[model samples]
Target: MRTTNRPASGTVQSVDRAVTILELLAVHGTAGVTQLARELGVHKSTASRLVAALERRRLVEQVEDRGHYRLGVGVLKLAGATTARLDLAQEARPVCRRLAADTGETVNLAVLSGGAVLYVDQVSGTSTLSSYNWVGQHIPIHASSNGKVLVSELDGTELTRMLGELVAYTPSTVTDRALLEDELAQVRQRGFAVATDELDVGLTAVAAPVRDAHGDVVASVSVSGPSFRFDEARIAEILPLVRTATTEISSRLAHVPPER
Candidate 1:
């Protein structure tokens, strides 16, 4: 019979300890269980269990059958993900700047993460009444234009699973799952999305999908401004520019157009 030696605290503690072990290995090249236990100020048994879990995940590996552990391929995999995100932000910066200049409204690049919209980059437009900086902020998926465009990529079942209950942020916010589905359907057909006084009473935004090399919707490009300034006529004028910016960014990401 095999007994599992789980961490005493919980998942969060286990993760923290695991990351610390990785950091120790990074600084020292390789470390034995006793050395890692001393560095972590935990029991040797605890360190051994944590290292075992990491090894199973391919995040750590031993030099031999019973030797010191070192970082593994999983670390490189995580590093690659971070590098890709940085590249995405770098590639989208110039495009967002151009969109902000062309539309005279704040431009943002956002991606869907954990059922919410995560703003990764932004460029403020030439306006005295500038909207607040939203980079590194997470907003609800049901209330923002960028969120709508991002969610439009998910199928019905996956969409429903992701958005359990549509929480309303403002009076105009769509809280009904069925209605939100309908709106996403329209977003798919129109190739863009609009949110006016939805997330905030006086905010308005328009967004288009940004695709990756495989044509997957990886992110969205949004132009946002005060509601009064983004009335129907103004939105009509700026929509094309926003779409063009998204297309340019997607092209930079190596998205090839489907052959007609």
Candidate 2:
């Protein structure tokens, strides 16, 4: 689906106020519209409208007798997804540590979030100086090895919609749509991606797709370090290890490789 920027300040404030109402309800366990309006410093009618919207989505449910609202099952469903992400991180922690140790490079677990690469976990190398922290950070989808691997399965039309501008972060960043498509094709064939100074002037990374029980690419396992030390020879040496780590992680997620 095509996305457009929110056009109105009132619309943005309405969304923010709605989220604050949810937060308030979460904290107090339950609240009436009047109390929410007082906390939000908005008119009672405004609070009612926000709560009404939330109710439509099952994010909030009204206590008909008490005239109050509480968080609904939708919140639990969202929280469950987060819990699964945490589980994935925990399960991949051992493999990330081993990869970092074996290559003396920083290792990361990332997933596609809002058309970007969200780094969920990280393991540092033996050398503290070479290690970089990126846990809980989102990077552009078109500029990183992890991002490429995550989107490798997308078809041309979907790829176009997903990557709108292909903004360049560095001189080496591939901004051409056709080139990126070609690179993604190669990534699929090789089952991995290598990005050399594509996202940053001196950063390099190699990533392998991490599949889930259904054999879907649910995440990516990447080894990243300074470009100077991540030369072609070093990359070749550790590529197998990176691939193995991803396979192990996928196995932890119950993804069984088909027997040859």
Candidate 3:
């Protein structure tokens, strides 16, 4: 017998309002009911109802002033929960280590989370100048090689929604949305990406996409270091090696799929 999946039907207005309240708090740092109602274009009573529901879930908390709300500790808890089980961090560690050892440059494994590229794994290089490990760090999508390669997979609307306003991380980061679109187009055509001091001064990275059996990009593998050693020529030299390592890791992941 065949079964049909029924579409959900419920009062999603409250949910939407709650999300709006969260977004407003994230953007404004804190807000009172009146401000939230105005931002959401909803009635004061409706905003109050939404805030009440969110308060019950610990997603939002009333500030000490009694009239304002801000994001609660529950959001941190939820974020931590995701950080604890980032699968790429676990699966890519050894691969990254091998790549770093072979290339004598820092190797990174990153996944797109929210609007940023989350560095879940890093293997330090042999260079003494290569700074601290970057595990659990986030880099902007338009300012990192891995981020650009990952962003290349997204549709235009989804990409715009993900990047949102394109705050410049550094002077070199592409802040113009149209220019970034053109850059992403180039990344797709090139099959890899290079970022020179876009995220930080004197830092450079070369990244290639890791694809699954279905040939869809799942993560990125990158080699990153200071500009003194990771120049344009050096990045071009290592691009093939990074791409090779990415293919190996993707094959391993496809053969031994991680258990959910």
Candidate 4:
């Protein structure tokens, strides 16, 4: 609750405090009531109430045999809910299954939300040793194949705002805004994207954009796995399959728009 030099709007202030609390726990590992209150510039009772509210929602938890607190399972549930609420998940399930069966690699459905790609559904391939379980997680919009495919839908100004101060998630992640913008333009022209070890050290993914009836990019369909099984040639091979899956999903989605 530190006062901003320029006062924040009410909504912005609430969001800032919520994000600050999360950052505090991430950086300090564990914090007690008084210390957190002091750090946040709020009263001890107010901090306690915030902690108690977070605890009730499983976003924070009290440490055992200690007065400190840490992040809890509720955060994971909240993260998972992003995917669970998507109408695309139900509509795209059969298409994802077909893609997984054909490619023998995990098939994922993702949509762009708040400048990040949120996985809405996934179907695990029947490989002898499969990899990746990021179905209900958020990944950087500039670092993944699905991300680039979705980012292609944004206009120049909106894309620039979303890509502000990009962080490198991996050695190959494009943190340079100009370079990433160029790549996004290519993705727009090509109708697909291939990311090799851009997010994880040895992960590769091929994604195609999913468009609605009006031709707006609504989501992305991807096939992904470990680098050992997803090399350049393999990614190129799967691109067509991913495109086909996305096409099918798009056709199904065209008939059913979300209720406003």
Candidate 5:
């Protein structure tokens, strides 16, 4: 095999090659297995394997009627999360605070970062469940209410990629892939995701999707407290509040067309 600029150390070989394939697609629009192998200086089969992996992850997709591949909507989902962070910084802070005040529970603004939920902003309520600042924490995508809301938008292939191996965070956690799929379906149907003692024994959270102008789910807004304090009746009351906060944040984002 020949050589490329993929880092020689501190990276898995297959991962490096996969990323290089994406970079190649990004720069040149699209390429087939033969061209990609020639550019990567590797055997065609190796390049094909890398492409197949990316395709499985929805990071790359086959072009219509051609064997060439290009970047996929999954890439947009990752990139859109960054844009969501930027939009949320200014528009979502007050909404989070209001939700915290209304519900007296911790409120978090999270986006899908790879297969994890990256909490970007938080507001603490009167209920002190944990002092740990959730901001910048990467929570497993299969565990939290916020994660469920975020993944509800993913297609079947992307959903599989996000849920590689569901680690049981708690006994109540959904470990079966089919069950998790059902849960996400309910989230999409009802416009909310509820995790009751699923991520932590004493924790319960309810989340709603934050949409952009195009109505795509970009982030999730959640309100969480100890399960004891978040009974079925209590969750019922907070669900509307969570929905309202998400609606407010999404409306603000969609109110006006972005400048050029």
Candidate 6:
């Protein structure tokens, strides 16, 4: 058994080696198991296991079953997803800014990632009060308006699986599974979602789904501010603006609504 250099803190050695194998194949176009073992400074069996795992996931494919492998279609699929996410953020920037200006509240773009709402982009409003920057932060899916809108399109089983446990972030958070399900149904019916002091005390947010070309909810657009400022009348006033902004973003993503 040969010993390879240990990975950095919090990094899994096997996973790191597997990724290195993919990078190696990407650079070399194709490589044999023996060659990969030599380059990775590992035993042949270890390299074979890594290659087999990637091959099982379709991340690598055997070259005509001649003991050589190359990157596979799964890599392209992952690249396409990454490109789509980048495009979604870029396309929503202007609309997010316009919404922030119109609503006088911070606007954010979020997508569901690893069972959490991942904030990808944001635009701050003109308010003097400092607002927290949520970009690159992951919030619980059950405790945010943006999260609700992102998950509103999912089916019952998927929704259940995505929300593992309804952890309460604040007193206003909906911790009940049944109640949350009902709220999600409303979000789907009304085409938007609202969270008042759910994720944090005195914070309120409203969000609408941003669809892709296939009409699937790929992300959410939201406006958030102090709960006191998001009163009933104010919510009524801003709801239309949020919905319109999200619609425009969806259109920019080539989403065509079905004709009535």
lDDT of each: 0.89, 0.89, 0.81, 0.82, 0.88, 0.92
- Tell me the lDDT of candidate 2: 0.89
**TM-score of candidate 4 to 2 decimals:** 0.65
Q: After the best TM-score superposition of candidate 2, give how far the Cα of residue 234 lies from its true spot, in angstroms.
A: 1.5
By TM-score, is 3 or 6 better?
Answer: 6
lDDT of 4 by residue, 72-187 (tens): 88877877765544667888899899899998888888988777888888889987275567777988888999989987878888887766668888889898888888898899
**lDDT (Cα, 0-100) at 147 in candidate 3:** 93
Stretches off by above 4 angstroms in model 1 are 1-15
Better of 2 and 6 by lDDT: 6
C-alpha lDDT of candidate 5 relative to the true structure: 0.88
On TM-score, the leading prediction is 6
Candidate 3, poorest ten consecutive residues by summed lDDT = 1-10
TM-score of 2: 0.85
Clashes of each: 0, 0, 0, 0, 0, 0
Looking at model 4, report the run of 10 residues with the lowest lDDT sum. 1-10
Query: Which wins on lDDT, candidate 4 or candidate 5?
Result: 5
Give lDDT tens digits, candidate 5, residues 119-214.
Answer: 999899977656568999999988999999999978999998887899998899999999999999999999999998998898899999988888
For residue 114, model 1's alpha carbon misses the true position, in angstroms, by 1.7
* Residue-by-residue lDDT tens digits, candidate 2, 61-108: 988656799999998999998998999999999999999899888899
Tens digit of per-residue lDDT, candidate 3, span 1-260: 11124224546555655666887898888889988888777679988988888888898998899989999988888888686446556767788888888788888888888888988788887873546777788878898999999889799888888887777878998888888888889989888999988989888899998876667777898898888898767877888889888877887767343566
